[model samples]
Target: MEFLAIILAAGKGSRLKSNLSKPLHEVAGYPLITWVSKAAHAAGASTQICVISPDEQQLYRELSHTMKTVIQVAPKGTGDAVRCCLPHIEKLPKDCPILILYADTPLIQADTLRDLANRIEAGTDICLVGFTADDPTG
Candidate 1:
């Protein structure tokens, strides 16, 4: 199933207290966003778009070979980040499914994404993946 993967990588990750962007941080030798993009691709996402903050020129250069990107001019919230991709989204087919992903959550598996897409194909309008956390604290 062909779908568009919108990887939100614009967060400043202030809590991490690092000089690098959150998504640029390495996880098991690969950048966090790279893992997310790989899972999206393996899940049959024909197109992927990464939403990044204005100062992420290095991130842009790294991702240029894999997918398109849109910049969030301001450090707005998630909604604004997604809005930056509106023009590109408009060009896709109306029935095309869109999968929203977080770059920091690299543990997500491609099989899970494929299952969600399968649900969408089976006529579900939306499929969300979430888990109940015991503490729900950072």
Candidate 2:
């Protein structure tokens, strides 16, 4: 099924206490955003848009070859980050499925995303993927 993957990656990573953006941080061999994009692509997303901050020039340059990007302008919230991609989203088909993902979550699997898309195709209005963590404390 054809779907749009909107990756929200505008966080300043203040919590990580690092100069590097959260998405640019490497989990294994690839950047976090790279892993997310790979899963999105494998799940059959026809279009992918990455939501980034204004100062993320390096992120923009890196993702330029594969996907489109929109600047969130301010670190308002997740809603505002997705809102920045409205122009690009509007151009897609009205009924097209949209999958919202976080770039920092590199552990998500492509099969999981495909299953979510399958649920949507099976007439589910909206699908949210989540897991119960044994230890919620960070």
Candidate 3:
């Protein structure tokens, strides 16, 4: 099935207590958002988009060369974040499967995303990719 991956990176990572953009924070040598975009590409995403806030645009534009970046000017919730991407989503083919992903979960794998899509292909209207976190606290 055709795939479209949307990676959300527009959040304010207040919990991390870092001056850097959260998605720019490195995990295992790569930025968290980069890991997500790579996984999406590996999982067969024909169109990949990484949504970011205006503050992050310059840095991500220089860094995320492979994935397209969409600007979310407002800091509304995820619903609003997804709405900012509708223009891109609408341009895609009707049957294409859109996968929503978060930038913070650097540990998330391509296999897990594929499994979620497979479930949808099999017949489910929707499926979530869940991972068992070893510890709940950051």
Candidate 4:
């Protein structure tokens, strides 16, 4: 079955207080989106799509060289960004599974995604990628 990994990059990240898109921010010397994209590829995703703010088009193009980019014209809730990508989602084969991911958490590893993909390939209807924090007060 085909798999589409949707990375959400539409947030303005007010908490960050910088001009950069959250995912385009540097993490461990690499752009956060790069790490997320690596995990998506490792998870056996045939294609990767990123939902990003339309105004951030230049940033998106600079950061995500190998993935498909979907423009979300307005900043809204996570659900809204996903809705904006619905057309691309619908164009996929009916059986294809779409994995929704946030672009800021670069620490998520490839093996984590592999496990999710395994479960998905085995017919699981939905899967969420998560991590156990080493410490909450770090």
lDDT for model 3, please.
0.82
What TM-score fits each model? Answer: 0.92, 0.92, 0.89, 0.84
Give Cα-based local distance difference scores for all models: 0.90, 0.89, 0.82, 0.80
Q: What value does the lDDT take at residue 43 in candidate 2?
A: 92
Identify the candidate with maximal lDDT. Answer: 1
Which scores better on lDDT, 2 or 3? Answer: 2
* Best of the two (2, 3) by TM-score: 2
Candidate 1 overall lDDT versus native: 0.90
Q: After superposition, how far is residue 87 of candidate 2 from its true place, in Å?
A: 1.1
TM-score for candidate 1, residues paired by index:
0.92
Candidate 2 per-residue lDDT over residues 86-117, each given as its tens digit: 89888988788889999988989999888888
Worst 10 residues of 1 by lDDT: 114-123
Tens digits of per-residue lDDT, candidate 1, 38-108, equal 99999999999999888888888888888999999998788898889999999999888888999988889
- Cα deviation at 4, candidate 2, in Å, is 0.3
Candidate 3, residue 67: the lDDT equals 76
The superposed Cα distance between candidate 3 and the true structure at residue 76, in angstroms, equals: 1.2
